[model samples]
Target chain A: MAVDNASITEVVLGGTRGGPDVKTLREDKWWKLPLVTVLGLSAFVVYATWAAVWGDSNFFYLPHNIISPFYSPCLAHACKAAGDTGSPVFDWWRLSPALIILVFPLGFRMTCYYYRKAYYRSFWRAPVACAVQDARPGYTGETRAPLIIQNIHRYFFYAGLVFNVLLTIDAVQGFIWPTLHHQLVHGQYVTQSGGFGMSVGSLVLCVNATLLWIYSLSCHACRHLCGGQIRSFSKHPIRHKLWKFVTPLNARHMTFAWCSLFFVAFTDLYVRLVASGTITDFKIF
Target chain B: MADVTMRIWRGDDKGGQLVDYRIEGNEGEVVLDVIHRLQATQAPDLACRWNCKAGKCGSCSAEINGMPRLMCMTRMDQLPAGPVTVTPMRTFPIIKDLVTDVSFNFEMAKRVPAFNPPPAPEGGYRMAQVDVERGQEFRKCIECFLCQNVCHVIRDHEDNKAHYAGPRFFIRYAELEMHPLDTNDRRELVRERMGLGLCNITKCCTEVCPEHIKITDNAIIPLKERAVDAHYDPVAWLGRKITGRKKRSADEAAALRP
Candidate 1:
């Protein structure tokens, strides 16, 4: 039997299933998608790396009480240098607060089901596009060491939920500004707490928080947690309801993943610009 | 109409090679139409499998220009200029010409446990539109096996075929798993026997889906997450222990195995 499995074996495995040596017989612009994926992901990674390490320590806009999503739950003592009051528990650690806080959210995004597809195709070039030969041949996938660690994605999802809560707190705090009026009544100057207000920065923070919440909630792990293990949805009404609410969001997880990623970076840039006096914090009220 | 050269694979189990055939193909014609013209005029012995000549039948699946597409669906004009190369699906052993033995898929299909729904209520099985719609997306699959052909697990390594059910059956499992009324506990089945763990989810299956199903996002990832919940989740394990709503025991799971 002279089975002609040669064409695919040649393309996929670089084997002599019986075809000519060719990168791909596909003549279309198949590379365009992988190229765009590389550019887009690389841009975000570069911007995020810059914002994390090299940004002017102005991640917190004091006037508007808006903290960058990158710097939210800012726990490091170095945050005080950035004019943001962080917990004394972490006062010992001296480095970028963004670095400490980013690991959880970064882990969440890195192990994300959608992101796995993006990076595997764009970065690893594992069959870069459908029917396209992979850059390298040996394939073990997530079943083995290193890649098997991706099974901890749900734990990261838990950590992401905690971060989402902290960021939501930061967004709520964005609404409470320090009143400009200073009082000397008690032999000490005091700025009254401005009760409730809104600003462009606050709105930005709110949107960032909302998007992050949606992204986290729309996670496949989240959807699974809600209703996956159960044999019957009718038996678990509460979990079923939660699953129902999340199912639609889960469908658009990819959209939220990109939109939230871009907005988080944009929110940081907005805070940086305002804190650096490059742009004024526009008050909507 | 213009004369177009098609470099198609011509061989049986023994061996074959790409043989070119110049035939008159119309601008509006599809690749299948071109093949039909070639079969009628040039070579009557040319073996090709097709039914309905429509994309819906999924019978005319082959690798056209290194991409798995239905011959009925690929328009001649859409192909790039020069000789078009058509080959049999590489995942399966070739029977003759463009036809390959797809019995592996059928064998895998038979291994899947039938949908085991719970006894219907007095009013019958009622499901929300959203719940039904979730499974509906998976049902759109025409079983063209493009996803199976493109999947790296079985494509690159034929040895994985025994354990791995490929993407087509994964969606089948997902559809059954997500069925609101299904009572079959398939968590162990998916992980152990069906080879869900082997899937790295590169999404080649999702990309090649002719029906545009979100195979990776809607089906595979969710199934992976479900498997995670079953075996890996610490919190879920704790809850199951406390509530005494234990997962299927190892003995129970083994009994259900083929």
Candidate 2:
């Protein structure tokens, strides 16, 4: 067989497989995922302390900001009825706390290439993940439990990405809206953001979303799924350019996985800070 | 010299039992050397398969002391202080003692189509170094059948044999798909018909691979993604519609005439 040594080098071990730039992140505290996770949780302690001294917030600036344009009744006319009458009531403090915890899995889910890789590598090999010799016969059957959840990563990715976009939009709303005081206005103690927590929350959310987006979009499986078009894409000028943007993210999909993981932790921190009131609801937008 | 105990499975499809033998060992002795000693003196009829016991050819796929290990590479001292065990691969049928019917692997190999190269350009073929690098992971496959033995698709669903082609074949499929000089439309074949959908991406094959090939990340999952793109991506379908005609014409001209 006239095995081309060039082909051997190129075909077997080429492309993103040999990128030499893994020096910075792979060797850091991140690889100690346990420590990152512990510290990530520990950040919550700081958040809790900050919240207890201050007070929880409900950052809703511009109380009349349109939440659901589609549901509003003023769309039929010139629509000049906006005076804080129809905006949906929301609790930014309560929501931020809930969102903090919810965002971790979302970020992990968004950028998780390892889930699929591990699923196929670890789960597929079954009871024989390791081989035995001269001992009792090994079972060659499918393994069960949490391992089986590997199949739905695609769907999970979709959910996390969508939630990221939605949360970013929420962050945007927080930026544009105004904060509230314990307005004895209607005497119901109706709390809302007249000018407080929304701006910082929105900024935090944007950074959080952008990082998570990079991590999720840079995923290895996503790259492969799209890379199928690499050959045909080479000829098309437009797709070729688009794929270039995706290439770096796709190349270091694992890096994105770790980056987005920490971002999610940071996102939860931001959400907790906003909700718990450790950081004053300056609503600085 | 030190004494080491071994439990060897000795039997056929009809019946089977573990037979023990004690052997003297020295430091730095390889498992293959110990097995050779056992075969030379005591159990002459013992059947085992090996070639290039240096770990290059990948022929010595066997489980050692209940762990899938290459007998050629495993050292006796690395094992726990007790009787070591040896057996044939589990996914494949037992052919005899310490040897299973691995012909299923070759049979699967036979099912894979021969590689077909794309048409040469008028000036000749060209490919980038960066483009061809990732395929090296696929090409290094030693055909140890360790991947096949470790695959849950084969181990869990023996009935999967009818529908599935297992991990090694996926490596083959991924290699061809990623080949810079090759031309084939095996992605849809691998995905829909070859049971690429069945691989949940556990990474057991990659973990056990002595070559350290990232079988799951570099090969199988990429192949699966190709399949998904081929089958589902509208843009890919469009690209194929645009380019498929030219490639098919070129392939027909260069490939063997039917």
* Candidate 1 lDDT over residue span A60-97, tens digit each: 86666888888778787767777675563577877777
Clashes of 1: 5
Which candidate wins on lDDT?
Answer: 1
Best by TM-score: 1
User: What is each model's TM-score for chain A?
Assistant: 0.87, 0.50
Per-residue lDDT over B53-123 for candidate 2, one digit per residue giving the tens place of the 0 to 100 score: 88888877777764566899898888777777776666677767777777667656655656777677799
| lDDT of candidates 1 onward, in order | 0.80, 0.56
TM-score, structure 2 vs. true? 0.64
What CAPRI-style quality would you assign to candidate 1? acceptable
lDDT tens digits, residues B1-258, model 1?
A: 679999998887677888999888887999999899899999899889999887888899898998888999999988888999998887788778898878778777766666666678798888866577668889999999989988877776666777788899999888987887766667767787678888878888887788999888778888888877778778778988999886664334334323
A8: Cα error in model 2, Å: 28
